[model samples]
Target: MKIAIIGAGAMGSLFGGRLALAGEEVWLLDVWEEHVRAINDKGLAIAAADRDIVARPKATTRLEDIGTAELVIVFVKSTATAKAAETALSLLGPDTAVLTLQNGYGNAEAIAAAVGAGRVIAGTTAQGATLLGPGRIMHGGSGETHIGELGGGLTARLEKIAACLTRAGIQTVADDNVASLIWGKLIVNVGINALTGITGLKNGELAEHDETRQVLALAVEEAVRVADAAGVKLPYGDPVEKVLAVAVATAQNRSSMLQDLSGGRMTEIEAINGALVREGERYGVATPVNRVLTLLIKALEKLPRENRP
Candidate 1:
């Protein structure tokens, strides 16, 4: 498969490296010139539990440099989804499948707007990676990846894509209810990311303290209410419990929002918690906790680099 990964950040680098090592033709495209140059010069380096695996995948900062691809995996920041989709037009062929495993909501719709609904696949992944440096990433943990068509059916193409991902060690499943899966992950992120970003706590640390745990629970409960009002059924039976379990499981891992703030970069808060607030307003559901979390994160985003927690 000719694969093109847009936004070759931590997640992008991880996927491209693994797939390229699996003998797939992978090309990583990103706006980071130094990262692209490093990948092109020295290959992508992925540090796993066992060893450091380096895979030579084509990479470029220039969108025009990429040829048409069969599969394009979008891993850009949620705030950049529309722009990423617009820029990704250069890599799309008629039959190309565009998959978004990004954080937050409306990514599929943004891509569908650019490439048509027939070519869009919405999904979520638990496989975590952390960027160590240019073209270098650490595999933070391994988890399931669920993908499905936006129209809600398990098609042959979906199965093939899942198989491709599984074969490359991504552990993917073709789900009929991908919206639920996406919401499930989003709910977890809603609880964890903002708390971590504000307090500088790791995933597991959120559960250890009653103070942080209360904030986490309230945020998730409000999000669950909004999701219920919107008629999006989450996959988890008890989303709060599931989120806490995930925090323990990925205890040492830092949330991506924390990583963004720590690096003095912008975050996906507008898309994650902010999206929840927007949906809550549309559905006439009160989301005070989520609204407050969103505001607090935005406040944190305003802090000077030296003053940030």
Candidate 2:
């Protein structure tokens, strides 16, 4: 299939470059001029646990340069989703499937606003990547990706796309209830991302501190209540336990939110903790811990790069 990877950051590069190496027609679209130039000029430099790959995938900053594709995977920041979606509209055909494999919640809804619900697919990935430089990404951890139709139509198509991803060494699951998967991902984000980000600590550090553990439980409890009100299921039997388990699994890894803070790139706070806070107000779930966490992260967001912790 002709594929377009919108937002050609580290994760996008992983998907696009690997797909291209697997002999798929892949185009990477992004606004980062240097990243686009690096790929188009020198190819994308990719290194994973299993192997190192250099893929000469097509890349461009021009939205017009991205033509029609059977699938478009969007990895843009939640804050920039609307603008990215507006630009990516050019690459969508009547049968094109647009998927958001971003870190936070509410991305699918935003994409649906631009491309219609039937064409928008929401996805979640646990794979981690660190961009060492323009056109270079270090695959830090292996993880699964789940994709599904938002308006509940393209099960077969998403399954086929999952096959392609798996063939390229990115394990994928096509689920009918993708919202549940997204909510599960949100639970992990709410538990560690902002707290670790604001504290300048890694995931394992949270468990070592009693204060952090208490706050984590509080925030996750509030998030669970908030998610329940929205009719979203927490994937694990116990939300707090599940989130802590994930923290243990990726103990040494810095969250994408932390990585964004380190790189001075914007965080996906609005779609994460902010989403919980908004839904809390809508559902009267009283998400005070989540609210405080969101406020703290927003404060860090306002600080100058030198002042940011």
Candidate 3:
């Protein structure tokens, strides 16, 4: 299969490297010149708990270099989805599948506007990765990946992509109700990401403290109510418990939001918590906790580097 990763960041590089190691023809496209040059020179170095290996995948800053690809996986920040989709036109063929495993809501809609709804696949992944440096990535954790058509149902194309990813060691499922999967993951993020981003605490620490745990429960409950009002069915039974379980499972990991804040980069608060606030208002559900978290993160975003919490 010919594959193209639209954003060659940590997650993008990890997926690209795994597919390349499985003998797929993969091209990593990114705007970062330094990262591209490093990968082209030394290959992609992947460090994990059980093993370390270098996978050779083509890397480039130019989209034309990749031409048309059979699969295009988008891993860019939610803020960049629109621009990335527009730029990805050069690599889209009629049969190409555009999969977005990015964080937050509305990504599928944004991509669909450019690539057409029929060609877009929306999904979520529990896999975690961090960029150690240029051309180097750490596979921090792994989990099931779910994908499906925007309109739902188990299509042949969805199963084919799932099979391809599974063959590359990424356990993927072609779910019939992918919206539940997306919303389930979003609720987990709503409970964990903002709190960790604000306190600079590790995932497990949120559950360790009573005060933080209570606050987390409140935020997750509000999100659940909003989801209920929106008529979205969550995959899990207890949203708060699910979030806590995930935090405990990934105890040592620092969330993407925390990593962004610490590095003085913009966080995805708008897409996560802010999206919840908007949905809550639209559905006439109150989401005070999520609203507050959204404002706090936005305020943090505007602070000077030295002034940020």
Runs of candidate 1 exceeding 4 Å displacement: none
Report the C-alpha lDDT of model 2 over 1-309, residue by residue, as the tens digit: 889988888788888988998889999988789988998889999876678889988998877776788998888788888877887688878888888888888888888898888888887877767678888887766677888889654478888999998888889988888788888888878888999888988776888888988888999888888888889865569887777767765566677888888877778888899888888899988988888888888888888887876
Which pairs clash inside model 2? Answer: none
List model 1 lDDT by residue over 1-309, tens digit each. Answer: 999999898999999999999999998988788998999999888888778889999998877877899999999998889998987788888889999999998889999999888899999888778899998998877778899899898999999999999999999999998779778888989999999999999888999999998888899999999989989998879888988888877676788999999988889998899998999999999988888889988988898877776
The lDDT values for all models are 0.89, 0.83, 0.90
- Our tally of clashes for model 2 stands at 0
Best by lDDT: 3
lDDT measured at residue 143 in model 1 versus the true structure, 0 to 100: 79
- Which residues of candidate 3, in runs, are more than 4 Å off? 307-309
Compare candidates 1 and 2 on TM-score and give the better one.
Answer: 1
**Cα TM-score of candidate 3:** 0.96
lDDT for predicted candidate 3 compared with the true structure: 0.90
lDDT of 2 at 277: 88
lDDT by residue (tens digit), candidate 3, 1-309: 999999998889999999999999999999999999999999999998889999999999998898999999999999999998997788888899999999898899999999899888999887778788999998877778889898889999999999999999999989888778788888989999999988889888899999999999999999999999989999889889989988887676678887788778999998999999999999999999999999888878887777654
- Backbone clashes in candidate 1 total 0
Estimate TM-scores for all models: 0.96, 0.92, 0.96
Among residues 3 or more apart in sequence or in different chains, the pairs in candidate 3 whose N, CA or C atoms overlap within 3 Å are none
What shift in Å separates residue 215 of candidate 3 from its native position after superposition?
1.8
